[model samples]
Target: MNFDFIRRDINAQKAKSQYRQLVCNSAASKGKEIVINGKNYVNFSSNDYLGLNNHLEINKALQEGADKFGVCASSSSLVTGYHYAHQALEDDICQWLNKPKCLLFSSGFSANLALFQALGKSEQSHFYLDKLSHASMIDGAYHSKAIVKRFQHNNIEHLTELLNRSGKYSTGFSNKLVASEGVFSMDGCQAKVVELAQLAKSEQAWLYLDDAHSIGVIGKEGQGSNYFADIDITMATMGKAIGTSGAFLTCSEELYEYLVNFSRHYIYSTAISPAIAWATKKSIELIKKEHWRREKICELSVLFTKLLAENVELVTTESSIHAIIIGDEKKALNVSEQLKKQGIWLTAIRPPTVANNSSRLRVTICASHNDKDIRCLAECINKAIT
Candidate 1:
């Protein structure tokens, strides 16, 4: 049989305790709670950072958009699929991020791929990425026509050295791009975006930020990296903190025009749902006005940290994500099982998602969670881990 290595690889994964599977959710408010197998769980693995997943205003906007423009784009963007709702959402994102232009995509993964492939015209283009960047980024950069390099995670010195030594290996590379995430997903740590911006400017390189995990969870109005530094290019997803679907990439007028014309991913793919685009705009509006939501998440995050036992090691972050390192895959899974028994839903993040011997419980503290929820979660975690 052809492609028979699939079975062997799967069995090998099972033997290593690295097999993956998905659990069905019976129902969910997707706020502080979710139901599975007819039992409710205090959801800590959710990405609904601002807890706006089921907001009434956004729902209303979605319905209105459906009634007006319908949900589907009905064709590729380059064809007749580009709708008014998509244009409005793009405009809103451009204003929110202070960018000259914006473009929408079905998903952040496709956006990343499109950007890298479009910019990587030839060997004259070089792409430098952070070591801990998302999988989509790695795939995009590697598959592109550009020369690619990875610096140590969050290490400004390493990145600087790589840039300084670029000419030592090759010359005449006109386009140099530096890419990083605003907030890393697994570790919940933030990139040093200010330093990156400065360095990229000095080196005449373009800075690209994937703010998927940071949007609607940072900045005064949740403008993410734009609030801290002026980035050359940026992509943020609506499904996470934005509490909607699809993604948007913001860039200069020149780059936007280039992508629309030259990017295969953007030119061929069907545009995102118009109704979801309308709902995403509403979510962005909510994100700007709802200071209480951000404040609550901060307050609750601090409380959760304080409540944890000293023996428990937590990766501290300014974002909604928190990682509790368990150091072993099976141990991490056991701890997750124990938490589930306590009616707390925590997921075990194992390799190849993370490094070997660094399995963890990736917890997301939402604005919807109260002090009582934090206290109980902390208490249960303390008992289970110990």
Candidate 2:
């Protein structure tokens, strides 16, 4: 394999101001603050929407789990790795989401890949996805044997039209799955879950939602899209507002059994840490019981929107993420840099993570953020953009 193309591509990315790099945090981040390069900044780039990252109860549960179940699962779930902790966690999730069964994976990406690939087993499998669906969903759908169609972002009419057109081709053996993100990661806007559920029912199709961004932020009890509609299959990550690690998919008992027997990702990969699963149960408990966290995020988000300058173009959303569109890749990077200098850690989101020339500042407002944090961030963003 030639390494020259890799170098060329990287150089091209740098030239276009699209090169990516990782920055390590020096310490465990607290509510709304992260230490990077020996300086603390208000962290508007985190997905810890409910601010439960370092909570005492969660930590205690983790410790207890480690002592009880050990840190590692030691092998794949089918290979005697699944523990009591995992079972308990799955049960907790099923109960919380009001689903018949739940399956856990090491990460949201893996969970998505598993679900899509498992469902897309044959040429008769048809998947209709949102154009703005996450990369994992796209990869899984395209890589599988399924015939995949993408409707315009959150365009129900387009989705309905596609489903109608494809209705004639449906057969008893064919599987039709309509997939979307509950809260779009980049745009931070919600999908029409209720409408999608209705369409799926009318079309005799299955609905799959990746609620990675919505699980701990939406709904009265953080049940996400599940609170609004009865989705066929729902996946959410524990890393975000749940403030742990791993991901889960909630589905019917039949689908759960099928995935367990056939899903390559789930069958081959090791299960998530039982310790984390135990901790995640505790996290979800807090997410359910403490409505104040969700309320705080809403309050802070409103304050942020109100404080933003008149000229700043922001994607209005009820979720934790807020995208400020900055068209040029270079301009977005510069704006991010300006905010960094002002002691606000906001990331510049650019293509191909987003569409070409749709570069943005993807600000995540967690419950930990206060009125002061929102105000300061808005003021800094206004200054930087202006």
Candidate 3:
């Protein structure tokens, strides 16, 4: 059969306001600028909150790693690809998070999938998650064989209700796992990690937090929400904060061993380049020593929020990610385009990326951005809004 139905559906999406298109970014220069569609734009859509991606030292470290280990590992970690660099990086992550053990994954997405599929599957197990958790976490729950229940976003009471009810089903399953994003990617708000941890403890459930945005972007010394929340199973990605590739999970030695032996994603995927691990080691050092990066991000976040609040309708955020709440998807897209016309680049985030009726322009601030960058962004957004 011809796939004209698919084509017609796509065209109907454009007519009904759901079609999507990708814009290619040709080049990116540091200090808050990116080139797209042959034009320069002030970038406010990147996740490099600490500005580590363009750090000269990080570049040097990556180069050194490459010189030592080349671009690719010969096999998977379960095979012979596990190198000294990989071991060192894993050690550093465990030390940083104060976890007894850590296991590396090819990506944060895979790590989430593997964790749920491997740990949350049981006739006696149930998976509970925040309604607004990351896509990976949601997908993991879908892939899991356990019963899945999503509580209201950041609603601790609702979560507690779920935990209490889960006990009634103990005849069917003996395990419960709670998953959430430490820092929500769209709204930039943090989960009540401590509260969740305590609830999980009282209910005898396992708590899993994905710290993709928070690690290297929040917490003391960038230890992530786990330090503040005292969580046991925490996943962090190196690509965002460490300015490298891959992801890892920090947990007790028992869980670590279980994942190594049972997590299919970890066992099946090709090992990341060992050089990336070496660069991760250096990144961990910078995350510790470069205390000023954290301070600078906090200051810039406040400045941007303050300036935007004076004009655009926006939410106040403690983290580097901020949102200008524009309700309709088409309206958000038009506003994003208007800002882009002024050489300011911000993505118009739409549902299903976020909840329907909550579409907005997501603004991500980075340490590399200066006051001028924030001021220009504020001015451009003001013009776009008006």
Candidate 4:
């Protein structure tokens, strides 16, 4: 029962499996390029889909918020830390998503953890998830102490079968809650949200959509995948789309208030800086005021997919995320290294991040990237593959 020996054994296995995490140093600029281990390269791996990371207006807003609210709230939200900025941002998200209410968390991970832990009852209730849902969701389900079931990714039939089986066992408890990502992070495939929503309705299950990757990049005004589908609760992260830090949940007013009262993650954790909340409010405004960004990103994504298809194996995704499946971990790593050497950088997405045998280079294209940047990326990819 020596835990140190057990930990060492696990670390050894991870090292042997090439599952070690690597660090990359980022440089400041248009935010499209970054420096990794002192090497300068064009970045194709960030989640800043609109290149707002270095936006002047965002910076100005941040300064303004900081000047007005100082650097820290210095307490948890339930302990007098919720500022006007926090309330404002929450309201903004509620309005944007057209929800009756919204609640904020420090990060998307925390938000999911709070939601699943609060809503997913232990044993008496079950949580069903997509196989490809983010680790946050899976970890949250595990933490929820619920009976966890997973259906095959995007396989409505598998989901339906699972739901049908659960229906027979609903005599003693809450049935089940269905959860999924709007966009699969590594593969870039979208959830069959509309279909899943209908299935949830017919099966009498509550639906939770974590639209972290799609919130800022998908839907008409970026209300996220729920706009295209029906969902009882929609979770999003400001860090991804709004170019700020923190997570949000938009749902019915009752559920929102319930979470504020009962969710441990929300009630216990230190609230985000009021300045960040203020900055996020401005970011949302910018995202709504400018509709062209979403359209431009969609166009770039399609263009990147089409061009990459000509030279290498690429997954067809309409979202901002485009992946080149290399299958083997080592080969994916090598391909990523080769691309980086050619001044193009994309992370080698490997097993554990994705399923076994689905390692890939997840290239994220932002609207800030011009056609020439994408063309250059295509050229680099072609050359690297050759």
Top lDDT model = 2
lDDT of 1 by residue, 224-287 (tens): 9899999999999998999989888999999999999999999999989999998988999999
Per-residue lDDT of model 2, residues 1-386, tens digit only? 77879999999999988899989899987778899989989899999999999999999999999999999999999999999999999999989999999999999999999999998888999999999999999999999999999999999999999987877666556679999999999989999999999999988899999999999899999999999999999999999999999999999999999999999999999989999999999999999999999998888888988988889999989899999999999999999999889999999999999989999999998888888888898989999987
Off by over 4 Å in 3: 2-5, 309-311
Q: Per-prediction TM-score, please?
A: 0.98, 0.98, 0.96, 0.94
Worst 10 residues of 2 by lDDT: 166-175
How many clashes (backbone N, Cα, C below 3 Å) per candidate? Answer: 0, 0, 2, 0
RMSD of each: 1.0, 1.1, 1.6, 2.0
Whole-model lDDT, model 4: 0.84
RMSD over all Cα atoms, model 2: 1.1
Residue 296 lDDT, candidate 3, scale 0-100: 89
User: Which ranges in model 1 have alpha carbons more than 4 Å from their true place?
Assistant: none
Give the Cα error of residue 54 in candidate 2, in Å. Answer: 0.9
Can you tell me which runs of candidate 4 are displaced by over 4 Å?
1-17, 24-26, 309-311
- Cα lDDT, all candidates: 0.92, 0.93, 0.85, 0.84
Task: List the candidate 2 regions with Cα displacement exceeding 4 Å.
Answer: 169-173
